[model samples]
Target: MAPSFGIMTAPSQVDYADVLRVWREADTVPEIEHAWLFDHLMPIFGDPAGPTYEGWTLLSALAAHTRRLRLGVMVTSNRFRPPALLAKIATTVDIVSGGRLDFGIGVGSRPSHPLARREYDAHGLPFHDAAYAVAGLAEACTLIRRLWTEDEPFDFHGTQHRLTGAFGSPKPVQRPHPPILIGGRSSATLRVAAEHADIWNIPGGDIDDVTRRSALLDRYCKDIGRDPANLTRSIHLPVSYDRPGDTRAAIREAIDAGFRHLVLGLPAPYPADVARWTADELIGPSA
Candidate 1:
């Protein structure tokens, strides 16, 4: 099957609810499955001091409003919330949305992003080294998945911390939990994805970069005795095409490189012409 082209709307510039609605309608128009939030506490490149909505809250509201659209954060920072609490919230939203959820997670360390750095400073979150954050994220992913699937309370010892009598309630609506989508390019991140991800997302990479990363991920899966094919591969690309052919080439390249899903980030309030064009033909192939 050809890859599905979903949208990830940045919540920094528009009313977040309106942003979700645009993609919710897009899902129906284009027969797409997933719609995402970029998971930033503040506007990144635009109006760094302006307001930005929380992804978890926005997702909950969207869950109530959307019926079939699978919702997710393109890549959520693990620093924003505790694993157990995040797990519970995700489960609740999954139930509310009738199981349309794709939980994508990643490390929170961002020394290069001024917006995230500002948030960390204001919120008193320690700015740890990249490796430290990725390691913590791995542990969080393990703990969150266990919380979603474990039937009995058990003591869980993570590298960074431990949980006692750990078990989650109302297990996620999707058995074994909603597909965990892990995103990043680093080796450590890929290993965690290989270990815990149902979908390993490659964020903003061209064909060569994506193929290389996919190969690296396969190596990690191999080291763990995992068949890389078991974990679906996806690409999330920032896109604005004056010509449909440009986006079409990108989509085809991703598919040919072995991605099963392609998430295209659009300009805020994705222009109707662009949306219709994508629905008509800009994706991987025949629509």
Candidate 2:
């Protein structure tokens, strides 16, 4: 199958108008199937003082503005918000987008990434160890799904989270909740994705490494009695305006590696007509 293509506009170092403009244009282009924003409370690249918008918040605004594109945060940090609250926020976005929402989530940024780590300190959010974060993410997926699908209010107690009388009202526009896309390359995360995610996404760069990770994910899925084929393979490839050929080559490699869902990451200070340019220069040629 031809891989589905999407664009990811990181909500940092760019004005809302800039992101909106690209999304609106992408909406009209049939070639662009979805759009995304990164989940970051602060800038992860360029200047640390640069403006950065909240992912879900900006996603809601973009969801309301665009008519056709399926939109979401590429992967929300599970640590940033309570599972129940995140479920509600995701439900709201799904409703706002008229069911055109893909719920992407992950265990959050690794503490080793200095730029991403500072956001936790600035926000007064606790930074747990890898084990705790991965375990919490697993628990979160279970709790959020129940909230989205259960008919009655229920309580949940887990290793990382505790909820009393938790229930999602005005459930998401997508029946049985939006498609869950879990992103990460760790084995632990791949285990979580095997059990919970409808799609699994990873950053693109080293095709060999990503291919190995995909094979690992297949093993994880099989171990859990789930068919690995049921989970869609997605990859995020950075777009290069000066080197469109490089981007196309990466796309082709990802597709050949069994990734059928492609998200092209556009750097900030976006060029005018970027979405169309993506379709014409990158996605079109790759296709």
Candidate 3:
């Protein structure tokens, strides 16, 4: 199957409401199966002082405004929110969007900032340890899935998270639950995604790296007696420019390499412009 392509709508210093207008416009255009937004409290790239929009709020807005586009956080940090709460939020958003939600989560790589840096100190957690982060994220995913799918009350006791007597109301519109997409580029993340994720997204890995990691993931899936094909493979491209010519060649190459989805990162301040431009020049025309 030809891989599907989508846009990443990372908010800049621009007003939140305005971005929604652009997102609605972009959503109306064909060839965009999904629209992803970054989940961060502060700007990770571009100007350090540049404005950063929160991911979940933007996703909620997208859910309310758009009809066809699958809206989700490109990858939200599991460290920030309690797993149970995240599950409930995902369900609520799924309901709001009439079943168009993808919960893309990751062990965040960005360094902590001052305003929100206290979260680490509060939890007595090490901010930069990738191993610890991956473990915690895995535990969180386990808890979330249980909360979403189990009929009776369940208990989740883990070193990083513990939940008891939690019941989520009005299960997500998607059967079972909204698809879970695990994001990151590491052995731990690959193993976690192989074990649990419905989809796997890698932000900026090369094709060789992606192929190698995907093979590992398939091995893990097969070992567990699960069909590896059930797991969707997605690529998150960085700083893509939709120049003249076959601008979609990159997307096609990723598709040929076995990816099912392509999430393009939009440059700041003009994210909508870039997204719309890409759609008009590349996605719409090609489709």
Candidate 4:
């Protein structure tokens, strides 16, 4: 199958108008099949005091402004919100977008990054060890899916979370719920993705590393008796406005490595008509 392309605007250090403008423009461009936002409570890049909009809130607003592009947070941090609440929030966005939601989630950010770790303390959210985070992620995935698909209220008892009389009313617009796209390159995450994710995404930089991770995902899928091909491979590549050729090269390499779903990450302080520039300068030549 031919590859599909999309754009991601990290909601940091940029105003709402800027993001809305890009999404509105990308909505008119058929070559751009989807749009995304990253989930981070504080600025991971740029000045520490810079403005950063909460991801799902911004996504819901953007979803209302655009008509066509499939939209989602690149990968929501499972630690930021309870699984049941997230299920409802995702459902609302899907409804607002008229069913054009791609549900992306992960085990949250690793504590190793100082910038990322500070958010947990700043926001009073717990910072668990890697094993705990991955296990919680797996349980969250199972619970969230049930919340999206089950017809009646149900109770969930898991090591990480528990709920009683839980149910999602007005379930997501997408039948069987929106496609769950889990992002991460960790083996534990790959195992969860193999079981729960319809689409799997990882950041692009080292093509060989991502290719190896993809192979491991395939093995995990087979171990569980699931066909590896059933899960779509997705990658996020940063777009360099100064060097469109370099961006195109990365896109081509990712495609060569079997990533059919590509998300081109647009840096902040976007140029005028950036979406058009992306289509003309990067995507057009690459195709």
Steric collisions counted per model? 0, 0, 0, 0
C-alpha lDDT (0 to 100) for residue 232 of candidate 4: 98
Kindly indicate the candidate among 3 and 4 with the higher TM-score: 4
- lDDT by residue for model 1 (1-287), tens: 55676877777778765676576676566456678887777778777777688887888888888777788987888988888888998999899888999998988647786566888877777777988898889889888888998889989777776889988998988987899998888888998999989998877656787798899999999999999889999888777666667767777777778887888777765665555556676653523
lDDT scores in order: 0.80, 0.93, 0.78, 0.94
lDDT of 3 by residue, 1-287 (tens): 56677877677666777677667877877667788887766655556576777688778877998899887897888876878888988998999999999999998754544444543554564575777888888898888888888888877678887777878887899988889999876888888998889889886556788888888889888988889999999888754554535346656656777888888666545544655677776665445
Please give the lDDT score for candidate 4: 0.94
Q: Can you tell me which runs of candidate 2 are displaced by over 4 Å? A: none
Q: Candidate 4: where is the Cα deviation over 4 Å?
A: none
lDDT string, candidate 4, 132-205, tens digits: 99999999889888988999999888998989999889899999889999999999899999999999999998
In candidate 1, which residue pairs clash? none
- lDDT value, residue 112 of candidate 1: 86
Q: Model 1 reaches what TM-score against the true structure?
A: 0.93
Kindly report which residue pairs in candidate 3 clash with one another. none
Top-scoring candidate (lDDT): 4
| Local accuracy of candidate 2 as per-residue lDDT tens digits, 185-205 | 999999999999999999998
lDDT of 1: 0.80
TM-score of 3: 0.88
In model 4, how many backbone clashes occur?
0
